[model samples]
Target: MKNRSFALSTALVCALTLAGCGVLPGGSQKTTVDVWLMQGSVSGEFLERFTSEYEKEHPSVELEVTFQQWTGIGKKVMAALESDDAPEVIEVGNTQVARYAESDALRDLTLESVRDLGSEEWLPGLAEPGSINGSQYGIPWYAANRVVIYNKDLFAAAGITEPPKDRAEWLEISEKLDGNGRQGIYLSGQDWYTLAGFVWDEGGELAVERGGNWEGALHTEAALRGMAFYQELQSHGDGPKDADEVTPPQAEVFAKGDVGQIIAVPSAVPAIEKANPALKGKLGFFPVPGKTLEAPGAVFIGGSDLIVPEKADHRAAAVEVVTALASERWQTELALTMNYVPNKTTLAGVIEGNEGTAAMAAGAARGRATPNSPQWAAVEADNPIKPYMTAVLQGQDPARAARAASERITAALRP
Candidate 1:
């Protein structure tokens, strides 16, 4: 039988307040409202500045922020929710929000509240997954879509002019930019997020819904075609093969000023500048080209969402923070300061006029989210498809690997 004790006790939590309840870490401040965020997801300064800003603006209400590592965060959250001391607000990956949403562990956001929060401009692709059935469980904090960061100097030295205009040209440019001590590009081995773009470009989706259910679509002819092209790019590029290219990611190597191209998030810009200042004016960014020669191809949007846990003591303060964080000011500044796409498409105007940020904004305009399934976490958890995907990248048959991987994904998605 389901445990009814927690539910029974929560009924006594009417108009709950953080006053005289939870204490901040390292100090005994009773009114402090604790917030939890994923480490390395947002700039520490921006995160801290908001906390400072909120505390100063509303000095009576304290905001105590904490960050957690990406590893095992879901488990940590689940464990935290079972206790009475869970943080009031949590920022979790958009993909992981459904797990808690479906479990009734998150606060249900209403349309009225969504409007009041100025989230009407929120990215639908992202906001949808955070909503279950018909209610919103989490609000998109910010987002990052893959944009092609290239070494302009390399392109010029290789006699290549502008960024590739199409899929074929993209490959050709990479080939021309190769051999003189630098890789045309580095494709990280076993990185499904990057490869998934080609899947959408080839008219394939990671998964499709039919008859009120979802299923993997990797083995479809169109998807296989895309997967084949993904392998082709690796074989043609002059970089570490799938095995040697997995760790450190292509972004790290790209920052060293040797690799010609890499598909990465806007945050990589700061890293590249920090690593080699010489590459500052030399680096350029564009959305990954697609089969149709579109400037911004279908990119996988990556980022987290802000959620109020069901166990929050200071619901009013937590909801206020949620609304404040989801405010247009916070959301827009988030993208501008951190180089991520904001939660809304309307904010694309903010990042416009700059080549690099503009390209990312364009990519976000055409971005896609991961498949929304409660079991998707499990699928990503025990991804049996990675080995076969690596096999394909390392010269194994693409078709065979796609078929096998698709079958595995299908089985994994099933009840």
Candidate 2:
């Protein structure tokens, strides 16, 4: 059963004071709202400033912020949600909402979204997953996506003056850049997120809902074509066929200066430059080219979303904190400070003159997320996509491997 015993009281308070203030007898007791933010989501300076400003603005409320690690966070979140004292607000991955909401432990934020926040202005990639069955469970926050980070010296050395506008041209140029002990791109075989974008570009979904049941669609013809394209692209690079990008740290690999290109968030530039300072001025960025020149390739929108746990001790205060973080004022601050794309497309101009973010923002327009199945997280927990990709790259029959993977996905999606 859902733990909604606190819903009525919390919702009532939020409705009365959407500004985050709480009314106590004599206004003596302060409401301490605990927020769990993913580590590295924001710098210490931003968090300190936000906390100070928020406390100053809402004298009756106290903000207690905690940073969490990404590793094993899924399990931690599930356990936290089941606990009686879960943090009021949590920063979850944008794609993780459906799985978390399946527990019915998250507060329904539809009313807050429509009334206090500009729901219509939120980015589809972040907003769509946050909404489940016509109700808002997650509040969209800042977003980031993959862009083509290339070594300009490599491009110039290969006689390529401009970034490719389409996949065909991209592949053609990539093949040209693949020689001379340098890889054209450092795309790992198990980088399923990149493969997902290709699947989306080819009009294939990772999974589809049918009559209230979800099933994997990786075996579809269009999806196979996407896989074929991924294989083609992988061939132009020397990345490990069995490992994902992070296995060897793609940024460190790129910093080695032998690779011409990599698909990564623009934030990777700093790490790349820090690893090899000589390449500082030689880096360039462009949106991941699509199949056609009309648009950029669809990328997996990577970002955080704010959610209020149902059993939070201070629910109303939590909603206020979420509202404040997702507000335009803080969104702008976050985008500028963290080099992220703002939650709303209308706010794209805030990142103007920032080339890396601009490329990411251009692709963000066509970004996609993982399948919205509640069981999708379970699928990722024991993912079949990575193995299927490895098998195909290792000369296994693509159809057979895809079928095996799809069947596993279907089983995982089953409750």
Candidate 1: where is the Cα deviation over 4 Å?
1-32, 56-60, 112-114, 118-120, 179-182, 209-213, 255-258, 269-278, 293-295, 353-355, 394-396
* Per-residue accuracy of model 2 over 237-307 as CA lDDT, tens digit each: 89999999999999999999999999999888999999999999999999999999999999899898999
Residue 275 lDDT in model 1?
Answer: 81
lDDT of 2: 0.90
Candidate lDDT values, in order: 0.75, 0.90
lDDT of 1 by residue, 173-252 (tens): 88887776788877766667777888887889777777857777887888888778777777545555444344765656
TM-score of candidate 1 relative to the true fold:
0.83
- Return the TM-score for each candidate structure: 0.83, 0.90
Inter-residue clash pairs, candidate 2:
none
